[model samples]
Target chain A: HLDLHHYLLLSTESSNIRIYYCFRNIMKELQENFKKLLKTERVPVFLTSSGTGAMEASIVNFFKPEEDVLIVVGGKFGERFFKIAKRFGLNPICYEIEWGDYPKVEKIEKYLKENKNIKGVFIQICETSTGTFYPYKEIGEVCKKYDALLIADGITAVGVYNIEFDRSNIDILITGSQKALMTPPGVSAIIWNEKAHKRLGVNKRYKYYFDLEQEYKNQKEKFQTAYTPSVNLYAALNEALKVINKIGIEKIEKNTSIMSKATLKAFEEINLKPLSKNPAIGVSAICLPDSIDGNKLIKFIRENFNMYIAGGQGHLKGKIFRLCHFGYIDIFDTLNQISAVEFALNNLGYNFDLGKATKKAIEVISQYKGA
Target chain B: HLDLHHYLLLSTESSNIRIYYCFRNIMKELQENFKKLLKTERVPVFLTSSGTGAMEASIVNFFKPEEDVLIVVGGKFGERFFKIAKRFGLNPICYEIEWGDYPKVEKIEKYLKENKNIKGVFIQICETSTGTFYPYKEIGEVCKKYDALLIADGITAVGVYNIEFDRSNIDILITGSQKALMTPPGVSAIIWNEKAHKRLGVNKRYKYYFDLEQEYKNQKEKFQTAYTPSVNLYAALNEALKVINKIGIEKIEKNTSIMSKATLKAFEEINLKPLSKNPAIGVSAICLPDSIDGNKLIKFIRENFNMYIAGGQGHLKGKIFRLCHFGYIDIFDTLNQISAVEFALNNLGYNFDLGKATKKAIEVISQYKGA
Candidate 1:
C-alpha cells in the first residue's frame, strides 16, 4: 500500500510547461475530489504546505495584528494554534482543557458570551496527542451564535471521521497529506467559506508566500498557484485522492472506527486502559501501568517486532502511548499492532495472557464484512 | 534529456520513513554537486520555493522592518527587490538604471558613501527582462568596502555564466530550478556566507514558513527541512545537478556563450539588434522594428513551428521579444530558434535574405569544439 509506482510514473513526465498546462485540470479534479469527500460546495479549497502552515495562513488571512481571538487547547496540536496566533501578534485568549478530556461546549459558549470582541475561535477536531475528539459541531454553533469564525484543525479528523464543512458551520477547515489522505507528507489543503473570504479582504498582513488572496485570485482566474508548486506531490496527492474516492470516504471512516474499536477491545483483554475520555477513531491512546514504561515498551516492540508506534508527548511522556489506525490501514495492521503490544508487554514481565489480545482482535475483525 | 526514468526509479521505493532516513544523504550529495558546479566552499545552499520566495527569504532574514537598504533596479526582476522590501516595511533606496543598461559600480559606491546607513545592496546578476548582465564582482567589492551585505539574484546567471562565489565576495546568491539548473520549476536555492548568517541572526521578522533560522537548524541537526519538502522535486533536482556536475560548469557556460553569440550573429544577419548594452549568455532580447509587431511575430513562430518563446513584460510590452537558450539546450536549439524567427519575420512582410541567419548561426556553432 505504501508503494509509489503510480506516483513515480506520473512524476517522470512532469516537465514545467507540461505540468503548467495540466495544473489547472489536476487542481480542478483535486478540488472536485475534495468537494465530494468533504461534502461541501460553499467552501473553496486551496493547497499549501503542512497543517501548521495552513493554520498560520488562516490566522494571518482572517485576522490582523493584535486582533482578539479565542484558542481552545486540548493537547499539543491544539496548543500549536495558540503559538501560531501569538507569533502573528494576535491577542489569543487560550482556553485550556485536560490532555485526554474533550472541551465542553457550554464553557466555550460562556467564554464567548463574556468576550464579545473575539474575531475567531481556533480548535482542533481531533487532538492527536491524547486521541481525544472534541465536540466541534456544538462549538461551531457557539461561534456562529457569537458571530465569530470557527477555524477547525482537522488534520487527523477530516477523512478518518465524517465532517460536514458547511453543516458544521466551519469557517476554515485544514488537513494534511500524511494522516488520512494516505499520501506522503508535504502538502496541505485549506477550505474556507465566503464569510472567511470576506474577513480576509480586510486583513492587512504583508505576506508574500502564504498570501491567500493571491492564491485565490490565481486559482480562480488562471487555475494555477501564485508560485511554482510541486507537481510530483500534486500528482501523488491526485492518485491518493483517486484511491479514497474509489473506496469511498464513508467506508474508509467505517473501517477506521472498526479498527479503533478492535484495538481498544484487544487492549481491554490485556487489561490496558484508554487515556482519552472521548476517544477519536483514527488513534487510540493507552495509559501505561506504573510497572511498565511507555517508552521502553515502544522501543521493545520496534526492536522485537520491527514495527513503530508513537510515544506520548509533553506531560504525558513515559506515561501513555498511541496506536494509529489511520490512512490506508486495515484489519491485518490492527491485529499485528495489538499482537506487538501483547508481545512487548509480556517480554517486559507484565502479567498478561498470551494470545488473548490477538484472539479478541480477531473476533472484532471477523464482524466487519466490507473490504 | 527531459526523461525522468531515473527519477521514477528513485521514487518507486519512497516511503515516508525511507525518504526521511535518506534525506540527509541526498542533501549532502546535492550540496557536493552544487559545490563542484559553483566552485565555492564558503557559501552553503539551502533549497526552498521559487526565486521570488528565495528573494523574500533573503530580505526578511537579513533585514528587520524599517531598516534601510539599497536596491539597484535595472529591469523587472531588479524592481521586484524594491517591492518586496517595501512590503516588509523596509526603506529601500531605489537606484534606478535604464532597462537595457547595466548599473555602474562607481555610482553604487557613491550612493553607499553618501548614505552610510544602508544594510544591504540588492541587485540581479542577469536581468531577465532586458538580458543585461551587471558587473556583480565590482558591486560585491563595493559592498564589502562599505561593510554592507551584497545579495546577487543569480536566477538566470548561475550555471549559464561562470561565477566564483568566494572570489566575488558575494554575501548571498540565489537561483531557481527552472533556469540553468535544468529541472522543472518548483524549488529555489539560496547560498550565503557566514557574514550573511550573522546578519540573519539579528533579524526580528515574525515569519514562520520562510524562517531561515529554523531551516538552517533543521538542516544542520537532522538534515531535513522545517516543513515537509517535495522529495520528488529534490530527486529530480539531484539528477539535474549530477548532469551539470558531469559536464562541468565551465563547459556549460561555454556552450551557453556560444549559443548566445550564435543567436546574436543570426539576428544581426537578419537586420535585428539586441536590446541590452551588456547582454547575458542564456537569453537575447531583441527590440522589434516599428514595421513589425513583436507579439504577432512570437505568435506566428509558435503557431507555425510549434515552439514557444517569451514576450516582453511591463513597459517593454509589444516592443521587445526574448529567446531563451538555457538549461539542457544545445547549438541545434539555437539554430532552430533562429530559423523560426527568420521564418516568422519573413512571413510578417519584413524582406530579408533567405537562410542567411542559419548560415551565420552555423558559422558561430562551428567555432565551439567541446560539448
Candidate 2:
C-alpha cells in the first residue's frame, strides 16, 4: 500500500522498544526534523490512522456542534470534512469548487463575512483526488480576518512542499504517514499552533479515543499518547523525516517540482490534457481520452510494472487518471511512468507518438538548475 | 516491557498490505482462531489501542451516564476501569477487593440485587498487579441473573486460560496484543456476544474514534476498521494466534499451570510465600521476607541475569514481587527466573538454602504427565 524504502522499513523494525521508549522522546527527535522540514515550531500529535482519522480528529476535537464551520470542497477529501462535521452535529457550510479548480480567497472571505457564525475553516493543501493544490495561506488569511481557525489537510502536501507554517495563518495541518512522509499507512499526524490548542480542551461529544485534551495531557505532559499508537510508524516517521532533512526538504521539494513539471509536460506532448489548472506539483492529474478506458490503462500499468497510477474518484472516475510523482519518486521514475502510459495508450489505438512523451519528460528534467 | 519471540517479530515484518488487503479477511481468520481459543462464536473487533483503551471503550459504548455499573476493583487495571467509567460520567459503583485477593461472587450478587439500575458489570479475569485470577464466570453468572452486561478484561488471562466464552455468559471480553496474544502493544481486541452487540449502538457520547457503531459497521459489514488499524500488529497477532492454536490453548494452559505450580513450589522451598489464595496460572505474586528489599532484589536480578521480576504496586510495593510465567515462556525459562530470584535473594543476605528452589521446581515440573 505504501512505497517504503529499506531505510524506513528498518525503522519500523526497531519498534519493539515501544514498551520501554519514551513516546515523547521519539517524537521530540522527529518533531525537530518536522520543524526543519516544514519551517514550523508547532507541536505535532501522532494518531494511529491513515489521514482520515486525523481529519476526523481535527473536526471533532476543535469544533463544537453549536458552532458553524466553512468547508471548501475541491474534491473527495473536502467532502470528507463536510461529512464528518455533519455526522458529529456540526453545521457545515460547504463552498464547492470545481474538482480541478483552486478555492478562491475572495469567495472564502465573502462566505466568512456573510456567515459570521463560522468558528473554523477547513481546506486541503492538495485535493488528492484531482492533484490540485489550493493556496491555503491566502485562505488562512481570510480565516484570520474573521478570527476563525484554519485547518489544512496537508496529507499529500506537507513533506513535498516547503510550507512555512509559522507564518502561514493555517492553525492546524494534517498529514498521513503513507504519503510524502514515506511511512506505510496507519499513522497520521496533526500539527497545530497555539490557536488550535486553545480550542482543544472543549468538545467532548463522541470524542473519547481521539480526545485531544487527553492526548495533549499524555503527549505533552507524560511524553506518550493517550492511546496505544502504531509505535513502529513513529520509528518509521523518524527515519523518513531524517532522510527528508538529510537530502534537505528544499532539495526534495525541488526534485518533486521537477518530476511534476516533467510529467505534465510529457502528458501534454501526447494529446492528453492536464486536469488541474493549478497543479499540486506533488502529483499530476491528466484527463484520459474517451476512447481509452481509464481502468484498463491503470490495470495495464499495474500488471506490467506493478506500479499503481490511480483512476479518478467521484464524477471524474473513468475520465481521468492521477499520476503521483510524490514521495521518494525520482525523475527516472517519472520518465518510466510517462513511457508506460505512452506505450499503453499507443497499444490501445489512441493516436500518439511512442517516444515523444519520454523525450519531452527528459527535456523538462534537463531544465532544472536548482541545488 | 514485553517478552516477545522472533516468530511474532517476523510476522510483523510482513505488514505492508494496509491499503489493498480487505481488513475483514485478516480478522476473519483471526476471529476463527479466537473463537476456537476462547471456545466462542462471538465476534472479535480489533482496535488500534492498548488494553486501557478497550476498557474505556467498554464503558463509553455500552453504558450511559445515567446507568449504574458495578466495577470490581482489585488492583491497578481494575482502578483503570473505575476511573475511565467515572471520567465518562458513568456511575461506577466500585466493589473493592484487597490486593492479591479474589472478588467474592456473593458480595457481587448482593451489590447487583441492591442496585437495580446497574446496567453492566466490569471485572478483570486476572489482576496482573497481584497475579490473582477472579472467578469471572461466577461474576458473569451473577450479571446474567441480573440481566446486566458482563465485561471481562482478559488482558493477561485469555490465551493463558482456556476460557469458554460461549458458555461463560461474558458479554464482552477484552485483551491486549502485548499480553498472551504475543504481539506488540499497539493493538487491542474486544470480543462480544450478541448481548453486548445489541447495546453498542445506543451510546455516542465522547466515542468518535472508538465509536462501536462505526467500528461494527466497518469491521462486521465492510470487513475493515472504522479507522486505520496497526496492520503490522494484526499480522503479528495472526501469527501468534496460529502458534497458540497449533500448540492448542488447552496445552498452553496446561503448560502455564505446570509452570505456575513449579515456580510456586520453588519459591516456597526458600520460605517465600505465594501471595494469592486463588492465583492465576499466568503469573505468580510472591511475598518477600521483610529483611529483603524487593527493589534491591529485583535490581540485582535485572542487572545480573537481565531478568525482570516486577516489584509490587500500591500497598504491596517493596513487600512482594510478581513473577510472570505468561505468553511464550517455557518451563526452562521459568526455572531460570526461579534460580535468578534465589540467587538474588541470597546475595541480599536473606537466609535461604542455595539451589533448593531449583530442586523443588524440578521436582514439581517432573510430575506434569499431561501431553
Across all candidates, the chain A TM-score values are: 0.94, 0.93
| CA shift of A290, model 1, Å | 5.1
The CA lDDT at A102 in model 2 is 89
Report interface Cα RMSD per prediction. Answer: 5.0, 7.2
TM-score of each: 0.91, 0.88
TM-score of chain A, model number 2: 0.93
- How far in Å is the alpha carbon of A101 misplaced in model 1? 3.0
Q: How would you encode candidate 2's per-residue C-alpha lDDT over B18-136 as one tens digit per residue? A: 24444467777877777788887666778877677688778878888767999988898888888888767788899998888999999999998998888999999999888999998
Each candidate's number of clashing pairs is 0, 7
The window of 10 residues in a row where model 2 chain A has the poorest summed lDDT is A2-11
**Candidate 1 on B1-371: residue-level lDDT in tens?**
23333333333344223465567887777677777778887435455466787888898888988888999998999888898888777899999998999999999999999999999999999999999888899899999999999999999998787787777778999988667877655567888888888887565535666778888777666767876665655656777778788888888888888889998888888888899999998889988888998889888977787676777878998788888878856788778878888888889898889789999999888877532
* Candidate 1 displacement at residue B345 in angstroms: 3.2
Clashes of 1: 0
